[model samples]
Target: MYDVVIIGGGPAGQSAALFTSKGQLKTLLLDNEKGLTQRALIRNHYGADDVPGGELVAVGRKQAEKFGTEFNKANVTNVIKKDEGFTIETEEGDTYEGKQIILATGANSKLAETIGLNTKPSSEPYVKHVVDVDAAGRTNIEGIWAAGTAAGVSVHTIITSGDGAKVAVNLLSDLKGERYVDHDAL
Candidate 1:
């Protein structure tokens, strides 16, 4: 079983994976390749003046991969809660087991709803729904968390990315039984 399974390959999911894997957790990122970021032509994100959304996402994926996060291109169909962890089913006939789950599926809440996660109307413009989460990204269901647009954050790439990182830190702290921080100094 993976230490963490992230559903979504957008900024939030990728950011979370980068942290989890770098933190030494076995991580898996499952993406369906259909995020709004893929079509964005981002210019407002911090540190970059102009960049294609797809390109940004591609780079993020590479960054996470560098930390040993496994990436799978598949549409997740179901997330079944198990006694120890979760069983993720995909449309491509693949199943992944993980001790924790992070929902970063952008504005799409279909999977969240199907899995019985509590949701509320989204505050972000154009997003109708989002998974209900605590300040630390914990869902009503234990072992399940959410970040980015799916967690009712702004659709902006920078904000979602930060939210993803925040959730990752919280999850890592839970796993480590103490506060977790990651820093690389030159």
Candidate 2:
């Protein structure tokens, strides 16, 4: 059981994993390597200007790995809040339990489920873009935080990456028994 199970491997997930691991929290990053930001043609992503979106993903994943963050290439299909923590279900019928669950699943494209016309296992949903978090990156869920596009961040690759870093720091503070505060400097 990890201290925190981040359910996405995007910028937000990676950021959270990096910080939590550095704080010595057992962290796991579950993603399928198709985060929305990975499809961007980034040009103004903070220190990385005019770089491909893939490169940014590579660098971020590598950094997180270096920090001892465990990466699992899996898709979390369902989550259940439990007495001690939470349980996550994967596409392969595997279950993972954690003390804390972060829903960094990212924005899934909205597809109106109508009279069944073959919407199952064919269309990959698009992310809605995370941008609802406050300056400190707290989400609407209690004890549940968010960052990056999962919290409704902008499409600017660099901007979202910065947003990830911002939320990451805030989460770190939260782990350290500090009052939940948003550190925008991330």
Candidate 3:
């Protein structure tokens, strides 16, 4: 079983994997190529003068991979709550289990509802629906989280990426049984 299973492969999901795997948590990142990252042409993200959204996601995935996050190409069909944590089912009939799960499934994504997350009509004009999350991306169900636009944040690349990092840190801290500070020091 992995420490965390992250759904989605956009900025948010990649950012979560970067921190969780670096924090000593075994991570599995699953992607189905549905995210809008590939189509984004970004420039407003801090420190990123100009970059393609897909390139940013690629770099983040590589960075996470360097820290030992497992990457998989699969279409996830369901997240089932189990005693050992959660069982992730893929369209290919493969299943994985993890101690925790992060749903970074992006905006207008409906995967959260399958796992019984509390969802509401999205207040954002462009978003049709969003999972309800606390400040740290916790959904109504324990051991499950939703981040990025999937958790009802602005779909801007920067916001979604930062939200991913924030949610990752929180989940890592919970797993560590203490607060985890992934601080950069000179």
Candidate 4:
């Protein structure tokens, strides 16, 4: 079973994978290739200006892969909670087990709804609904989390990315039984 299974491949999902994998978690990121980020032309993201949304996603996936996050192109169909974790089924007829789940499917809560996660009307413009999550990104169900626009954060690439990282840190801390921090020094 993977330590964490992240759904979606947008900035939020990629950012979470970067941290979780780097922290030594067996991370798996599944993308359906249907996020809004793929079609964006971002110019306000910090540190990267005038970057195509697709390029940003590509680079982020590469970064997460560098840290050992497994990447899969699959459309998740269902998530069944098991005794210890969850069983994820893909539309391609594949299955994966993960001890924890992070839903980063931007602006789409259909999967979350199928899993019986609580949701509320989204505050973000243009978003109809979002998974209900606490400050730490935990959903009503334990071991399940949400981040990015799906978690009611702004759709801006920068904000969603940071929210993803924050959720990762929280998950790491919960697993480690202590505060988890990652800092690189030159």
lDDT of 1 by residue, 1-186 (tens): 999999999999999999999999999999999999999999999988799999999999999999999998999999999999999999999999999999999999999999999999998888999999999999999999999999999999999999999999999999999999898999
- The regions of model 2 sitting more than 4 angstroms off are 109-136, 139-141, 179-186
Q: What is the C-alpha RMSD of each candidate to the true structure, in Å?
A: 0.6, 6.5, 1.1, 0.6
lDDT of 2 at 47: 74
Model 4, residue 81: distance off in Å is: 0.6
Query: How high a TM-score does candidate 1 get?
Result: 0.98
Which stretches of candidate 3 lie above 4 Å from their native place? Answer: none
Q: What TM-score, over all chains together, does every model reach?
A: 0.98, 0.76, 0.96, 0.99
Prediction 2 global C-alpha lDDT: 0.64
Judge candidate 3 at residue 169 and give its lDDT.
Answer: 93
**Candidate 3 local lDDT, 22-134, one digit each (tens):** 99999999999768888889989898879988888888888999999999999998999987799999999999998899999887566787778889888777788899899
Model 2 TM-score is 0.76
Per-candidate local distance difference test: 0.96, 0.64, 0.89, 0.96
Q: Compare candidates 2 and 3 on TM-score and give the better one.
A: 3
Over the stretch 103-122, how does candidate 2's per-residue lDDT look in tens digits? Answer: 56456522112111111222
Candidates ranked by TM-score, best first? 4, 1, 3, 2
Query: What is the clash tally of candidate 2?
Result: 12
* Residue range with the least summed lDDT across 10 consecutive positions in model 3: 107-116
